[model samples]
Target: MTVEGFDGRLDRYLSEVLSKTRSFVQKIIEEGNVWVNQTQVLKPAYKVRSGDIIRIVIPEPKQLSLVAQDIDIEVVYEDEHLAVINKPRGMVVHPGAGNFENTLVNALLHKFSGKLSSINGVIRPGIVHRLDKDTSGLLIVAKTDEAHIKLSEALKSHQIKRIYYAICEGVLKEDSGVVDAPIGRHPVNRLKMAVIPNGKQAVTYFEVLERYDKYTFVKLRLKTGRTHQIRVHMSYIGYPLLGDSTYGRSKNEFGIQGQVLHAGEIKFVHPITSDVLHFSTELPEYFLEILNILRSRNSKYHV
Candidate 1:
């Protein structure tokens, strides 16, 4: 297909045509998928002249048994700049570790018809932020470079607000408090994050929304985005999230998969228009069920 754009640079044009990152687009060009005026263009920095015919032959991305399953996703907002999706429990955000296929990325590829921002590369197209495989709720995606840059800046500056709902294993003695600590990979166990003296600074504010005899439902706001910040902080303070296997509590009576946490809400300014954008997703059924059980048990015990 021939696209006509005036005075646009070659890299930008290729990125748009391939719906991928500059790196991926360059890789495609290197692999000989882009043709300019019937000749293959090798250089990403090649400037284009007016009335130039740019032909982009996008090869099918290497198949990896990653079928684009039509998994149902709740979309809160979508535009040219970004999109908000309500991810469900038991869904892996991206392919990693032993999960090579059947991930949110695979579903997105099938749903979006491979038209995703490639800034994060092929395996993680359009991914701006991420959630744990079992931690359900809202996530954001960037559709373009402008959107990606803006969102990344917002995240780095802590302007983008992310609020989560977590049911912890024990009742907090205080009504609310802050967990200000430094987080880093455990010196001995690389798989786990720890609050160490020389670690990166991390902060979290929490308020107890409901208190059960054996659990506490709290709303947590992250001041910094670190891997497992919420989980690590809560565990550090002596109340690990319910069903969290890695931290303090190793068992759950509720029989829930993974942790009982949700990325319930997100707020940020639009990258292109500077409009304030807010999105929220309700707790999944499993979460509500646990809450109901706790509430029911608490009521009877209190009486």
Candidate 2:
């Protein structure tokens, strides 16, 4: 499709259209993989007008094997078409490079007995979306082709609302607001995501649920789910999540192992029956402990 009056910069446009994460898209641009109207445009922040046909070429990540390694998974909801699980912190959803063992897929294989859909190939049998290794939360897995297609459609249409709760490192100035910045890999640091010119369209909505002496409890709604979207957006606005070393903060006070965030809730329609399905999980023990510590410093806080 041709470009429109979308005021976002070039990277944002390409990212939104390609549906890939900002970091992946940015790599493509930097490698001379993006062209607007057949002309290569490498600037990440170049603005564009309507009807400007843009092309982005994204290279596939190195292929990895899906090996079964007997990791335990907390199953929350399961049906013929999908399975929702409380993916605990430290569990990798699928097997990838450098991590072929001790992943959720291996556990799924042991539990489901090869029943998950093979559409995602042997490596990621039923994965649609993904959570970072450190982010614990609810995740949905598809079992059949029909179910997978339906769930995919729902996610793309934004009908599947994924909400997260996080404890950011600082107090937020606004009670509620949207982070509508384009995000991509850091130009200098390939490991981190940043608000760069040739970044992808990323939007995150957050509301302050409570405030502490040095932290804020925030509820986040993702308009788009990119790799590290919430973390990057929060860091871009100067309120990185506690223990999220990749984004901005160098450390966490609560002694947590990873980022202090959780996929608190998810709402979607049943792929088979079309019934509305909603599931929520309480914060993990460590998450609550951190919040308690922060709130304890401020006696006005409530659980």
lDDT scores in order: 0.82, 0.82
Encode model 2's per-residue lDDT on 1-303: one tens digit a residue.
589768778777766776544544666787898888889888788778888887766666444345555667888888777899899898888988787788888888777776776546568887878899999999998888568666776777788999999998888979999999998888998977888888888989999999887788999999888789999999889999989888856766556667888999999989899799899999999888777777678889633
Q: Could you tell me which residue pairs clash in candidate 2? A: 3-51, 4-50, 11-198, 11-199, 44-197, 44-198, 45-197
- Mark the regions of model 2 whose C-alpha exceeds 4 Å error after superposition: 1-65
Residue 109 shift from truth in candidate 1, angstroms: 1.1
Model 2: how large is the Cα RMSD against the reference?
Answer: 7.9
User: For residues 1-303, could you state the per-residue lDDT of candidate 1 as single tens digits?
Assistant: 555655666777766655445666777677777788888888887777667887877776554445677777777888877888899888988888677677888888777766667566667877888998889889988777668866876887899999999999877889889999999999999999999999999999999999889888999999998998999999999999988898866667767658889999999999899999888888888889888888887775321
